[model samples]
Target: MRVGRGAREDRADARDIEWPPSARSPGPAGRAGAARALAAAGASRHRARDFAWPGAHGAEAGVSGCGRRNILLVIFDSLGEGALASMADALPVLSGLRREALRFAAAYAPSPEGGPARASLFTGLDIPVHGVWTDGVALPERETTVAQRLAACGWRTWLVGRRHLAGVSNWTTEHARPFEYAHLDWAHGPLHRSRQNAYLAWLQDRAPAAYAEIFPTQANADDTDCPDWQRAAMSALPDALSFNRWVGARSCELLASHGRDGPFFGIAGFVIGETMGAAPRQSSPCEALQERALRQADAALGDILRQLERSGLAETTALVVTAARGSVAEADTDAPMQESAIRVPLMIRSPGLAAGTVAQAVSTIDVAATLYALSRVPPPRRLQGAPLLATGPGSVGRGWALSRLRRDHGWKTALRHGRWKLVVSHGDPDAGVQPGFSLFDLREDPEESRDLAADQAHQGMLETMIDLMIDARVAMEDRTEPRIASF
Candidate 1:
């Protein structure tokens, strides 16, 4: 019963902490009715459509049958493509997956922040459309998620770790929309003080010694006062009790229990790489910390994949590995529109798809469309993303990848066209300044060192890119419920 040191003493203290049973059980279904009530309340204003049940669509081109396929989506927070490539040697499992899976070198997140980026990935909508433009904003309950869609289509959906679709200011519990996840191991971050955080609860039950060491005072103590990197370095928790490992174990448990029941859509989200936890060293450079977190994540991923194989669900499952945003280092930069801030590692290993690298630009939103395709469900009309599996290697993923940042000061948008990247910033309107722009030919300047916005010779290209940016924004306008017939 004693999983960690000082388990006996910690058990005495655990009695004083308030732990919710729902944290260790299946998610509540009561939200489904609440969702209907909210919809009815706003029916006159919004006119949301009813949920469309999925029918048997024809099989995808490369896939064998029309049966629904299992989906395993693993997301690492703030993991940049550059970081993954730089530390490939240290990540054996992930590197091996990269070689065996369909690697997308030019994949980009829809937003550079966790909330908006994850919203786009789940809803296949742009930041403006979904309305989760930044970290603190809540995803509107009316907006349907991929998990809800799949659940309606007879697929079991589960999520483990880091569902930041809504605000997490309250420490008692995290929020969940209608039927978003059948089972959830909710933890906004490793060090969050939520009593409903399943990761923390698991530590209390299974590894009380480690829990007592990490949180010496109260079970819900706010340990976030210390910087994440410093806390990670100073922590006494072992690799076995790390957050990512707990997420992986929960995912494997779900797989083993539900693999034979029906097709399932599961997400295992790892936050270590972003928060700089689970490192072996007490203190290290930023790069070393990130690399160590990645290695730990790799080990956890190996466990999940091996569990998939053991359950005989490997071939029937479409495995997706990606990041919610880009590198943590981007936080220190002036502008987050850089490639290192938005570009992320993306790979997919499906039953019939050939393993190869794709250089075509793709957005994280495409992952939602691809999941719908794999499940034999028609993508909703409002989805702005196209399935990547339908596109060839040379063909563009979504024609271009777009990233957006919205703050109190202004709005910053970046558009990546064939070889060019255009970044436009609209300053606060009251300041009375015109929008400024920057152009970079990624082929020539991959690091985006030189800005061509002021160059006279590249004026023509800049104008063209500006037009594309305008067109893209116009195209992304909300179309969730179009006026079928002007009444």
Candidate 2:
């Protein structure tokens, strides 16, 4: 493991890192320069106002063409598509939003783990390109996030709840990158005792009794031996004091307090279902815990949406709801390469866009591209994803998604193209284990019960999928700084 920097060294390193030109100057002059840069890229603010969906009506029709819209990206950790569908009736708010949102039927995370998956969502780059292949891996400072890009273009960026861009440990709070977020309310988890945890601080200030009962500050009162489920249950307080509710309340406050001066970008990261437990004694208890957490999270989602409507920002705000990775309940095995492990819920409710299901397969990395499209900011050349709103041929609704998992458990890669899904296990040669393959026709077996890799009849299909996977990996090779000259 790499040694973490001391507080003083961390501060110095943050100061030494070069910020973007717009970030260096915080007033109108910086904004104007960013505007000029947008103009040079043929995406001026004025042109952004005129932007409209193809075959869609103009300003009179209430399409999102008025100006740059505020963006609220809500990520529910471990909330998979299956879980959402199964709990739809219990989650009235999410169900209602789904009716009026553009839902992606086949959305996959870039990685089957939280850190790399979120890194891809933020940077629009694959896990390999970003090098955050597992949890605890720090995102390189050089990679620019969509939040930074929007902040550079004069948007007020805020982050509430968890942001696993850096490793979260019991010893220290995770550090934020410079100018990454203008305002931050960070809490790694509800039970975390990090002094920087905003949730616990809020509990202490608002509900001292509950805070004292739940979080005794004595170092000897260690509950490390207790199961995660029991700990989560103990920490799960009333609606007003719950971690998810706190995140929702803060996001609503941010939205309510904002003026009409400039567009804003906020990320509300909720961690309820994610902490149900690392391992459950029984599936029933785990399922029940997850269900309860989802219901709470649903209420939180409702709070944010109602605040948006009540504050009159609903019409001009683009709401994106997705997950970093799937839940343990959805996965059939402990392996991270399964479809259930990476397939997540993704939906976008933007101005002027019609609500419907998009059948094309897409990756969460596309969320970054979609944000840039909504804000009318020219996405950096390093972005590997295309705008989700782009229409006609060669659009982002490509019928394929890729997910990678490289961790202590194993190195696995999964590719979904058309109806076929292929998973390749690059076993450790040093361990004397040979590589393995698993193929499934999702249409025929959505549960992925039977693997067709050894079937004689499907040999041709397996070879074709192998070739497609190889081509995809080659295509996704880092082009952030493409070679201009052979010399």
The positional error of residue 155 in candidate 2, measured at the CA in angstroms, is 0.2
Scored by Cα lDDT, where does model 2 land? 0.71
Give the clashing residue pairs of candidate 1, or none.
none
lDDT of 2 at 474: 65
Q: Estimate each model's TM-score.
A: 0.81, 0.81
Which lDDT tens digits does candidate 2 get at residues 290-367? 666677778998999999999999999999999888765543355566766788898889889888887666789878
lDDT of 1: 0.70
TM-score of 1: 0.81
lDDT of each: 0.70, 0.71
Per-residue C-alpha lDDT of model 1 across residues 209-238, encoded as one tens digit per residue? 766666676633433353554465424467
